[model samples]
Target: MKQLKDITVIGVALFAMFFGAGNLIFPPQLGVMSGASWMEAIMGFFTTDVSLSILAIVAVAKSGGSFYSFSSKVSPRFSIVMGIILMLILGPLLALPRTGAVSFEMGIIPLFPSIPQYVFTLVYFGMALLFVINPKGIIDKVAVYLTPLLLLALVSIIVKNMLMPDADFPLTKISNVYAYAFLEGYQTVDALGAVIFSGIILMGLKEKGYTDTSSQVKMMIKSGLVAFSIIGFVYGGLIYLGASGASSIPAGMSRTESFMALVERVFGQYGVWMVAVTVIFACFTTTVGLTTAVAEYFSELTNNKLTYRFNVITITLLSYLLANLGVEQIVLFSGPILGIVYPAILVLVILNLFDKYIHFKGIYSGVVGGTLCFSILMFICESFDSLLVVKDWLLSFPMTTFEMGWLIPAITGGLIASIIYKIKATRTI
Candidate 1:
């Protein structure tokens, strides 16, 4: 009974942490695009957004519950590089600021259109900083207070939409529904988040006295399953709601606009406040978790040369400035950067899962390096007109059409590295 209670709390907290800004906005937009193919679209979205995220958690847990340990198998330098990148991206550079931007856009602006975004962001990050400054109690605070309200609002909206007569779903606007949804899922960035968040979860479990490695891994896996199950349900409902309203919503509506439109359609004029309540709490909990995690990470990385309190202040202030960029612009800026980083992280997460069996540590460098090189190439070719030939050649690679052009290189690189390591060992013997 006690174990169940602990898992439920940690799991709900985990869900709240991951289900912020991008998680909320992306689903309905994908539903709008996928239209009648919503099922396929939701599955594809689940494949990356929820499934990969859960896998990342398990991977980190199995690798001793710290991203540094999980990543350092590639090399200590690689670990530090990955750590800095993850913290920055998950910190002021992207995700943290996004929570504030999303909250202001969806939560504040909708209710008080005349309120300056900068003003709302100031108040928003101030509140987030209060929670994060004392990081030990963050999980309890989020799970006990914030998550339930967010869930209630979301569940109510989803249920109300379900009871309504379905609007005719227009033909899907996408060419390949699965691939489009899969790629779009990258916007959630939860997989990247999972790598960092696993440590937080482990810490929370440790606080509950789960000290041993075996027990920690078991609890972490259970907590992840519980967290992602709820995420999958909410995502599916949101996507369905978007599909139902596809014909009625405007073609060029921004994700925030479409989401607000759906809320109003569900609950009438009063839905404005409901939208405010949902977005603010959802983004609030996430901001608290992320700010705490990133602050703790950098403080420890620098051996407390950067104090946690100082890191917290810096992150909050920086996020506030970036929040003023608005949601759309922030999201646009994040895409190429996430595209380049996510594949390498994904490869690392998968390799770390089987760390006990894989004696050749060089395989980690080979696989991740290969993935990164190909991912950068893919990004380059897609970005520049002069690289059309390179882009075409990349498209010829398996799964490139699915935006997974890194897979072949990763496998080939791992094999080559493994053979080289074996030869070296034989020569030494």
Candidate 2:
């Protein structure tokens, strides 16, 4: 009974961390486009969003709860560089500001059309700052109370929509719906966020006397399962809700607007209120978690030269400025960056899972380096049309048709590195 209680609390905390304001906005749109193929599309999405996330948490746990430790397998220098980049993407540069942007868009803008976006952003971050500043019971409160409310709101919508299914709308078919959805799932950035957020969970477990390495890893896996279970159910239901009520969504509506349309159709005016409440709590809790995690990381990295309060204030202020850009702009800006970063992140997390068995250091550096080069080339090509020559060559590689051109290179690089490592070992002997 005691063990069950512990896992539940930890699991809810993980859920609150990952289920940001934007999370509610994305899945329904995928459902709308997916139509009859929602199941396959969602499975592909679940692979990157939920499965990779759990693997990341387990990887960090195996590394003794330090994200940097896992990355350091490649090299110390590479670890520091990757560490800074991940913090920025998962912090003020992206995810932190996104929470504020999304909260205003989904929670405040529709209800109060007249208010300036900046005003809501300021207030959103201000509230998050207060919660993070104190740092006591924030995680526990979110896990224990806030997550259930978010779940309740979503469940209510799902159940209601299922009982009285709306008229079917025409399904917009993508050539490869599953692959497209898999690529689109990159926007969630949950896999990267999981690596960043694992520190908070590890900290909680340490406080709760989970000290041994083996125990910490076990707790992380169990808690991750809890988080993913809720995420999968809610994500699927939201997708289904959007699919079932597709007719109500106007053509060319933004993802956020589409979701809101679904809610309004299902629950009428009261649905707007339901969405607002859910967005606020869900976004707010996520903001708190991200701010707390970022602040803790930089503070420790700087050895208290940058105080926790100072780091939190700095991140909050920066996020406030970015939030004013609105949700669409932030998400748009994040795409190219995440596309580049996520490939390396995936390679690192997945390889680290076999850390004990993969004794050769070359395996880490080779695969990650290969992924980084290809993903960056992909980003560059997307940014500059002149790079089409390079892009064309990369697309010739396996899985490139699916926008996953990095996979073959990662495997080949690992194999070559293993051979080199063996040759070097033989020469020394």
Candidate 3:
């Protein structure tokens, strides 16, 4: 009974941590676009978002449950470089500011359009800073109390939508539904969150006396299953709701607007309050978590030269300024950056999972280097008008049609590095 209870708590906490602003906004948009093909689209989205996220937790558990340990298998220098980049992207650069923007747009603007974005963001981050600066039982309490309320609201929305009269799904706007949804899944950023937060979950398990690696991995995987099952249900329901309304919802509506319209359709005027409550609790909890995680990481990295309080203040201020950009623009800006970084992180997660079988250390460097280089090349070519021809030619490369052009380079790089390693070992012998 105690073991089951511990897994349930950790699973709920993990779900709370991952189910934030992006998780809420993206699925409905995918549904709107995919229409009758919503199932295929969601299957692709699940592959990258939920599946990779669960694998990330298992990988971290096997790697001894720390970002540094999980990443350092490639090399210590690579670990620090990768860690800083992950922190920045997950911190002030993209994810943290996004929370404030999402909360304001989804929670505030619909009801209180008079509230200036700058003003709301300032107050939002200010509140988040209070929780982060003096975190105590309140943070845990918020997760325990508010998370269930949020879940109830969401489940109610899903169930209500299901019980309502069905609408016809329009023809899918996308040609390759699966690939488009796979790429769209990058926007959620949960896989990245999973890598960072797995350590926290492992700590929770340790507190429950699951000390050994084998027990820890088993417990973590079970908890992860619990968290993602609920996430998958919510995502599928939201996508279906969006599909049902695709013909009625305006084509030019932003993601937030479309979601708001869906809620309104379900509950009439009362949805305004429901959305407000849902977005506030979801985005605000995420804001506090990201801010504290970023602050603690930098403070420790700098060996107290930059104190935790200093980092908190600086990060909150930066996020506030960026939050004023609003949710749509922040998401557009994040796409290219995530495009470059996500593939590399995915490669690392898969490699680390098979650490025992991989004899050649150079395989890590080769595979990750190949992935990063290919991703950067793709980003650069796509960004430049003059490089259109180059982009076209690169697209002809193997697996580019599937949006995974990095796979071939990654495999080739690993094989070459293994051969080189064997040659060097023979010479040394």
Best by lDDT: 1
Tens-digit lDDT track of model 1 for 1-429: 999999999999999987886777789889989999999999999988888899999999988998888898889888998788878888898888888888877787767899998888999899888888887868898898889999999999899989997567899998999989998886566888888888789889988989999999999999999999999999999999898888878879998888888888889998889889888888888888888888888988899999999999999999999889976787787668778888888998899888888888899989998899898898888889999998899889997766788999999989989999999999999
Writing each residue's lDDT as its tens digit, candidate 2 over 279-341 gives 888887788888888898898788989999999999999999998887678778765787788
In candidate 2, stretches whose alpha carbon ends up further than 4 angstroms from where it belongs are: 165-172, 332-334
What does candidate 3's lDDT look like per residue over 95-182, in tens digits? 8888898888789988899999999998999888887785344335445866797788889888898888867799999899998888
In candidate 3, what residue range of length 10 has the lowest lDDT sum? 134-143
What lDDT would each prediction earn against the true structure?
A: 0.88, 0.82, 0.83
* Span of 10 residues, lowest total lDDT, candidate 1: 326-335
Our tally of clashes for model 2 stands at 0
Off by over 4 Å in 1: 332-334, 382-384
Error of 1 at 19 (Å): 0.4
Would you give me the overall lDDT of model 2? 0.82
Q: Rank the candidate models, highest TM-score first.
A: 1, 2, 3
Comparing 2 and 3 on TM-score, the stronger one: 2
TM-score of each: 0.95, 0.94, 0.92
Ranking of all predicted structures according to lDDT, beginning with the best and ending with the worst: 1, 3, 2
Q: Give the Å shift of residue 143 in candidate 1.
A: 0.6
